[model samples]
Target: MILSWRKKRAARRAAKKQNLEVTSNMELTIPSHFRCPISLELMKDPVTLSTGITYDRDSIEKWIEAGNSICPVTNQVLRSFEPVPNHTLRMMIQDWCVEKRSYGIERIPTPRIPISSYEVSEILSGIQTAKDQQDAERCREMVLKIKELAKDSERNKRCISANGTGGVLAAAFKTFSKVPFEQNVALLEEILSALITISPLDGEAKSYLGSDSSLHCMVWFLKNGNLSGRRNSVLALIEIVSSDQQKIDELLEIGGAIEALVKLMKEPISPSTTKASLLLMYHIVSNPPSSANSKVIARLTEMELVKILFEMLVDCEKSICEKALGVLDEVCSYDEGMEKAYGNALTVPVLVKKLLRISDLATQFSVSILWKLCKNDKSEGGDVLVEALQLGAFQKLLLLLQVGSTDGTKEKTTELMKLMNVYRDRAECTDSLDFKNLKRSY
Candidate 1:
């Protein structure tokens, strides 16, 4: 009777375990909530559902707040739109890999045409021989051939099935970088003319000007030529740098580029020229060089460049204001003296007023500048900064923090919070008039 009772308990336990396993498998088999309306594929990164709903993985938790999750297909409220979970996905992939490995499945086969080092060396030697002989026509042909080889090499460097849309642009930069200085200058002129005449090459030409090669050429021009050459090079560099948002860091790194650019910004020029110079100046100021020289900062302030930047922030042209604010961001990075000069220039109020009046890129830029200035720990614009906060600046910044799509705006939001926290802490510690009530509204 004891043995029979033990057998019955073991059987009951095994049945319960099997039932649980079955239930788990059934849960996993349930279909996902919705498919993409555009591609009909499972919703992936930047997933947008029907009823105009969208959520990235990072924001999905916030999006799911208040439990309003709904089906994209029928617009019916969903209890949950939980995905398969990352660990489950990883297990699936691992299982797939194991199965493939067991079956001896080959994904990427070995290349049929392997590169021969000896053949490459022979080709390089011939090219060198042509150049050594000073055979201009032969060398030009060799250069063209070498460019082709470089393109091939670049193609091979990328994944086999990867997109090659940017490859041509990359190759152009590579080839231009290797050209002699004289040839490079001529090429720059050609590219500039091409940009003016051809719409198709406009993007490519702009990219070429911003390339490291082009920057190197600008450095060469700055060091080797007269004042006029330096001015022209700076102007050219400014034009290229202002065209694309991604090249800002590379633009800041050129040798003596910041000082040269600041000099251009200070010189008296026509409104259009000044606007262009100011635009570049703003980018330089907002982004700042990785390393800045004290002398450069002094010269910029002495030349009244900071004041000019302040003026540009309130300029009639929205584009100019936007770029100037970008520069103001960088300018505030200097020591306390520079910060005071920046605050005394009435930059904060101008930016606050602009934020109210302009709602475009200029306003966004102005808000970014204010965020930087007010947040700086050493900033001396006490009443002005507080007034900016009281005048709805903090709310504007918070809104930007909440909705901004660009990485720059996101970073500005984070910095703004840090500064506000410092202010909050200071307010708590001191008998200084409690602007707490005022700041809270913001």
Candidate 2:
């Protein structure tokens, strides 16, 4: 009887152990921290909202999509709607899921590591070291890698740009620019491409790029590099000069800056490149260092910039045309520019055609250019007045006076009209188009 009782007790213990195992297997509970607050289920992808509350990405996104502006738990207004990924929590949840694979749980795949400022700095440091050692291949590789990272995402670009990448780029440019043109031309082009990619370069970054060596190097690129390189160089130069007037003046002092810019403008490189070149020229002529100087005018005209302006006036896009006209207006404000404009066969007719056709800005610039061309005693000669009358400048001026125009443009138009009237009879086409309705607002 004792043996029978021992057998029964042993059997009962074995059955009890089996039952305990079944119970444990049936109750697969998730940790509270692993569960999303909104769903009360295991979080597959946890993200932290701006209110410091964490939730599964799908659940929170659904909740926000339902027009719920406040946090579900705290009922607090979100500081910003941008949700940050809870990387640490995600890792923990992923690990737990892996350990529970026997319970039919799948492992969460590793997330792609987002590019950060740290990564940018590390890559830049490597580039600098490679460059210092004259490791051309290594430097090229690192620069291309940086360009890839910067192009991969806007966040990456912002982080890279915000973390002194400009100075790194400037350093790389200065280093590689010393390389023989045939040896590192492609590498320099890549660097300039990278520079233009992170554009509207900030004040500090602009200051770095605005350095004399950088300006000279970029000018060299503009003059010597290939098509894309020349365009990118122009884009980078725009950012550097756009920083301030001092930088613009400094760039103007560079020997080949204006000549290269004019060449870029005239070339059918790309609309964006041409537009940026025009903008750079506009800033230079409009700002200090005085656009009226004969030497400045001579540089611009010597490169056939005036001819390009007339061509753009008829064929280029509205913004380019406006800027082209603006630069022309500034150029014509000087005696030398006036002569260049008057000499160009297309200049007067194109200026007359754009008078009231494109935009108010175009009209203003057109009138200003004509005004400069016809300035009575201040101008070189009265021949431009007869040329203007023949080209129907008086008609456009009268139309500009009658139409809605800025006060400054109206003043210029009225002055031009009066000047043309003084020489209207000498020109072949002296008949003014109707001026009965002409009225100046200022």
Q: How much is the lDDT of residue 226 in candidate 2?
A: 76
- TM for every model, in the order presented, reads 0.39, 0.68
Model 1 misplaced stretches (Cα beyond 4 Å): 1-191, 194-256, 268-272, 278-305, 333-343, 377-381, 386-442
Clashing pairs in 1: 282-327, 285-330, 286-330
Kindly give the stretch of ten consecutive residues in candidate 2 with the minimal lDDT sum.
Answer: 433-442
Candidate 2 off by > 4 Å: 1-47, 50-113, 131-134, 179-182, 244-255, 287-292, 377-399, 421-442
**Model 2 TM-score on a 0 to 1 scale:** 0.68
Instruction: Give RMSD (Å) of candidate 2 vs. truth.
Output: 14.3
Question: Can you list the residue pairs that collide in candidate 2?
Answer: none
What lDDT score is found at residue 318 in candidate 2?
Answer: 90
Tens-place lDDT digits, model 1, residues 1-442: 9999999999999997887666545533212332334344333333334443443332453445446566544566755554222333333434443444423422322222322444445544654565455444554454454334434543222221122212233234335545475755544333232222222233554665666776776666555545545555556656666676556667556666666565555554455555656666665554434454444455567656667666545445665566666666566667632564454535655676675466557666665666656655353635445655545566666666666547876786667655655444333222222223322111
